[model samples]
Target chain A: MSHAVHSPARPSVSTQTPALEVHGLGKTFHIGGLFSSQAVRALHRVDLTIGRGEIVALVGESGSGKSTLARCVARLEKPSEGAILLDGIDVLKRDRFQASRTFRSQLQMVFQDPFGSLNAAHRIEHFLRRSLTIHGKGGTGQGSEAQTRRRLEELMTTVGLQADMLDSYPHELSGGQRQRVAIARALAVEPQVILADEPTSMLDVSVRIGVLNLMRKLRDEQGISMLYITHDLASARYLADRTAVMFAGEIVEEGESLDLLANPAHPYTQLLVSAVPDPARAGSYDPVHRARLRQAVMASTACAFEDDPHQRCSSEEPVRHQVGDPRNGHWVRCHLYRPGAGAGGHALATEPLPEPQPAA
Target chain B: MTVSQTSFGSHEPVLDVKNLTVKYIGDTRSTTAVDNVSFSIGAGEVFGLAGESGCGKSTIANSIMRLLKDPANVAAGSISFGGKDVLAMSQDELRRFRWQDVAMVFQSAMNSLNPVLTIGEQVADIFTTHAGYSRKESLRRAAQLLELVRIDPARLKSYPHQLSGGMRQRAVIAMAVALKPSLLILDEPTTALDVVVQQEIMAQIKDLQRELGFSVLFITHDMSLMVELSHRMAVMYGGRIVETAKAHDIYTTPRHPYTQALMGAFPPLTGPRVPLTGLPEGVKFHNIPDLAEVAPGHFVAPFDADAEAGVLEGAAQ
Candidate 1:
């Protein structure tokens, strides 16, 4: 078992500022009667931060709060607790004007289903034109309409689309084309950070890589910090620099993408890694073993062992511990990495985590 | 592995779809969803159709079942199941032939189950409609079908929403195979499911196919799963089968450039992360001109240099 000392929380490294900092984010949904019997806690004290120019992946199965976390970052859904700080400003605390102004070119989101996200009634040029006009990015020259058209063509070319697609409606285009259009639209705003929630899952497997490669190109050229949310570890590994594995609304494990993937510290991470189909090792495990492992993992409660009594397992809340060098930014939240004993130094120095922003 | 168990049972093909073409008709130009697709399923064989989305895998499936709605024309080809031409049959005849001889389990088909009805009644409905069985007989058969699919017979009373995704899928499988159809068409059957659930569903389906001696035309986009489950596989590209070969050969040495790209396209978890690759730099769509047989029982669609050059020119323009 990979082991390290347990540290519940640690302060952000002083020199390295986070592009987006989130602390103690929470969301709850109430259902049923006045004396409501059911209150679903979707997110509980979720804390995550994406450093500048870094692509942090939020990965999990459906309902694991990966999408919820993405929505929270995008402010598409309001969080019940905690702060969302984008580039040193608390977005959740600022006024509408201040928030919009700051976040206008700062943050933007790309949805999963390109077809569903795009307006079917509008032509491709209409969307690109609106985005460019709204952001005041297009040229202010003679024959400006022509210039805008040229700019739209340029954007289309950049996204692996053709000039003819400008007049084409969403319905006329295939899924990959629509996604390319969506990416072009996102690029129109020139945002510093892009939050893509399963952006390629709905696309064909053959076209999925093309979109992912485009995103990587954009990230490198534009220096745009991206939060790529996906359930597939392979895709996440291909694109993301760091990956935070979320399970039932908590960041159960997080680390450098390759390290965490190759040496998954958490049980949940191991289960996810094992779940990925590797053609090399087909039929290694029988149906019985697969079923047993799946059942055991699913039945395990979300509450860390310490929090709930019935939890025969130790702490359900991971004992946040560093696996590799902090400089490398590898952190895991599992008992397997109990600080100070297993792999590295026994007593890791504790510092206060980033402070929560004041409420609006 | 189980293919041999029923190989000698019948020389007759379970399903032979010849030159099948489906076009969604409209006021102007109709949209061709499937074009000149020809394939046959031997008795107890799992004939896999692997393709990306919009490649017409499901269209062929829908056409085979005669479940096409209005404005949808079956322009050409014949779907012969158990020696009966399906496309040539009238609506009345098709209805009688549907569940009794040919069953289809669509992608996310578990959702097709009625949330209001118990699993038993839904499955029993198949028997009552197709076999004209009494309620008592249908219920007993439903329980037995559930057993065959590896689900507890007690789940017959459970609503569709009450079961796990795997169980719900099993329930759907139970319903499909309730009448023991000679041929089963599964269209991306486990697409919506996770890998573990997907594997379990595949295993259960394989077990049932082996025991009951039914041929399965398993359709999915995932190549690895196809290799694991399929006896013979066909790769579809832009409404055409670009390649058809034994599953082992397709994996070991894929002949088509499209197949080569597809096999190398996916980044597996355990493997070293290779930068995601695609068709040539500017290829818009996945359409190969013609499939050529490279070996006995193995066919591959070669990359058309002219077509590739044309696509590049279009991109340039």
Candidate 2:
């Protein structure tokens, strides 16, 4: 494969500061009027980082607050707490009222639905050209017209689309093609970081890989950092360098993609991995057991592991415990991995912790 | 295991679709949505039809339920359920045939439910209208149906919005199976659901089919779920059934290029990662030949020169 030779080594963590670092990020939504509003914590002290030219996947089920984190990072929502460091600078503290033009140019967001993201009334070129003009990359003058046309063709080619597609309306393009146009528009601003929220979820199975490959190509060629958010674990494993599993608005597990998925530490992450339909696996899902796990996970605000003997799981929040090789950056937030807990300590942590059996 | 337990193909199929052709008649030109496609489901069997969007899998499901409207017309075909001609049914017969003999669960069926009405009222409506039961008796039976799907009978009083996405979908399934239909057509039933919820729903569907003895015509684009659930499966592309075989055979040794490509689309979670370029760009398999029995019980469509060339080029890249 072409990418086999071109596949760069996984970016080293300590050598350079990350392109984007989110520390103790939190978001809470209030329902009803101010007088009698109910506070819903959509995000809880979330911390994640995307190294330069690296891809980090934020995976979770629906309403797990994965999308909420992305919205907060993109400055679409006001975060209740924590810092968003872009290139070692805290953008949240600097941009108190609104996101400045520099912050906007440095960070771009690609939404899930390609059909809804693109305007049906405008041509593909119109969207791309508008982004370029807004970012001061292109203009309407006669001399700049030629330059803009060249840049437009370059964007189309980089996304692996024919230049002729620029003249076509958004409706005429396939779902995959529309997604490529969306990515090209994001790239028009030459942003250093991109946050894609379920980008390939809407495309057909066959065409989905094309878009994924395009994202990988962009990361390799342009050295742009990205946060790929999706509910599909297989795709996350296939594309992301690092994977973070989210549950009930909290980061439950974070590690190298292959290591985390192959040996999930958190009980919720284990249930998620086992739930994915893998033709290679022999046994089928047990609906009764799944129902019990689902109920336990949703009903409890503390640890999802119901079998934990330690009362700390129910009474207090679990902290991040280093598991497996420390250099691999694999960690989990579960009471089972507490320092003095029977299951605590590394080396033997390559396998999953003890299975959690919900009470009858 | 489910497929091996049942003695399929020896008995008359519960649902037999033969030479089915459906077209959408537009003003400029008519487009064939489903072209000369044929498949069958035995009693208590699960038959999966998989393809990308606009591949006519859903169109086939819609035609079976007689839900096609206006521009969508049945161009040519014959649909027979239990040796009775479905296309020849009168308005009254059609009404009786639907839900009584054959039921359907559309994509995102959870949202199809009315928010204002309670789940009990909705499920009981089926019994009162179809089985001619009293309102009290229907409500009692509705509670039983909810219990069968493992939802609390007390939830029968709750509105659709009150339940979670998974519970609402189970409620929809309970209503579909209330009439004890012989065949159930499920079109992308778990598309909008999360993986865990999707697995739970599928497992429940499998259990229900076992207990109730009903055949299933499952339609979806996800191949992994199809293999996990279906007994016999068919792969469709561009309005054509390119391959049909037992689920195991389709997963192990898929003959059709399109089927093989579809299998390669999903990346493995385990194993050394490889750069897999999913279905080649702009390569549509046109002029597909009819399915031939290449092996005993396995059928595959012979690829034309154009398709073979396209697939080869894609593989080379």
Candidate 3:
């Protein structure tokens, strides 16, 4: 692909360890009282890796467990199972009860709601200074105050905000400006990895691109890895180097962002790609077809492609199958891609499905 | 007015707004939220009003519904629905006109719904209040409305929290169309919904519109969704319409600098990846001149020579 040539900021393949690596990450929530508690599986064996300077986008609907995965990685929620490796070191095993200061400094998280994340009482500078002091970056000496001031200004500049805004409260700034301040606070600790969960979803459409660009700039210049969790496929395609599509608490498809979206292997991913509003494409909204597809997707417990006769997709869990070139890192968790499923299944997996027809 | 006449030449206009201005007055200062905005929705057409927050899209919707509270007053304008002046309606007449002639679906369906009551009770309340139907008849009609929006009639007894976000929105839509209103104003109806659910809701709205034949004032910040659903659209910026045209024409060739910047904000899913700077830093197209008909049905606010040169330079990158 010409992405290498066009995107000079793309990190080359290096022998250095990945910034974040998640293996068999799973989370299950217990609901109701102790008499008869119900176990709800929020995540299931999610395996992901983000290289230094790479942005991997996790895309899914509200209940698809994308946020849960991010929470697990950020240590907000303790994963039920699996290991989390930060810079090839297993931090989960080391710090069982609480996240160590090193782990906190190395991995920071930016939440969705900028309005709710920041304290209303504190000024923008207070948040950044707190992060710096908590991480031991801000010193107590006389010259240290100037050093901290310079660092705060640098952080503000990195996130494309003016130093004068440091005095403003959360309520005084606009949604976009508040989000930039949030990013600056995350950057205050000089994190190696940042888990951004729907960072720009709450911001205005015109301002969303600015935040996405800032994220890319951070990855390119600082070599910081990022896990961008969002439901918007178009934004993920624009910002992420790779995309992993989650469906019903599982990764349905994973590959290079453009390649996966352009040639979606999983039925769920196909549905998502088709559902995204594309102005260029002719309007295709068949209510009946959409209803049937929604029903099928919701009804399936193990796999989305439950109609596949060769494989029992409704009951049996689908395994990951490589699609196209192995080096492309394109794969799908679908029964259709299973080995020896049949010629028909193989053809279905290879050729993309036709777009839904517009209403008559 | 000429632009409306050209666009709605075949179909009759359901809602006509002319020189509409809404201002929020403070003790010492007054700020215009909707500044001399004008547009008309043809019968059975989806007319989209798109802009960022605080651009006065919602203010226009509120003015049309006469739901503006204290401090927010209609400064100047005439809003006519089927040749009847909306601003001149009496309180009693306005109450009847609201649900019987026009209905609105707010941004958040969850907030719109009464959490303490069942879906059936909420839907039935509209019919009982406006249509003067008996409780039994209204309940039956509520079940039918639920079915129309693809929600199970059994869920009629369920609370708003029991249903998903998409279903909650559908329930709201079902309620809005219960009285068979001539106009339905949806203010960011599916903004809180997921992509798939949003598509489904849009499709459902399209199907309902086709069946019932009601004009829609679909307001949202998402231009892609707006283009997909709207027949004609007006792009708002700084309390003024910057561009107005057919959905296809606006998508293909946007003339206004704000419209162009908005179009560039959306990155394509299946195209060459390029970094797009959405809006230039600190660039505001404020206090623009009136819209001039650039094409047959296309209307664009003509920027002055100095501002035009600057905006073009800023947006062109």
Best by DockQ: 3
Residue range B241-279, candidate 3, lDDT tens digits: 999999999999998877877888888887799988887
Ordered by TM-score, highest first, the candidates read 3, 2, 1
Q: What is model 2's DockQ versus the real complex?
A: 0.53
What number of backbone clashes does candidate 3 have, counting pairs of residues 3 or more apart or in separate chains?
Answer: 0
Q: Candidate 1, residues A128-224: lDDT per residue as tens digits?
A: 9998898777877788888888899989988888899899999998888899898899888777678998888888776788898888877766667
The lDDT ranking, best first, is: 2, 3, 1
Q: Give the top-scoring candidate (lDDT).
A: 2
Q: Cα lDDT of all candidates, in order?
A: 0.74, 0.83, 0.82
Which consecutive 10 residues in model 1 chain B have the weakest lDDT in total? B1-10
Better of 1 and 2 by TM-score: 2
Which stretches in model 1 have alpha-carbon errors above 4 Å? A1-15, A95-101, A133-154, A291-317, A324-328, A335-360, B1-8, B19-36, B68-78, B90-92, B115-120, B136-170, B280-293, B301-317
- lDDT at position B76, candidate 2: 98
- Per-residue CA lDDT of model 2 for A1-360, tens digit only, reads 112112133344333667899999988787669796666677878899888888999998777789999999999999999999998899999999889989989999999999999989999999999999989988666799899999999999999889999999999989999999999999999888999999998888878888988999998887778999998999999999889998767787999898899888776777788889987784656545544544434333445444445423433455566668876698888633321122111111112324433211
Candidate 1 C-alpha lDDT tens digits along B201-310? 77678778878888888988888888888899998877888899999889988876567767766776765667756544334456456667889989877777566546
Recovered fraction of real interface contacts per model: 0.39, 0.73, 0.79
Better model by lDDT: candidate 2 vs candidate 3:
2
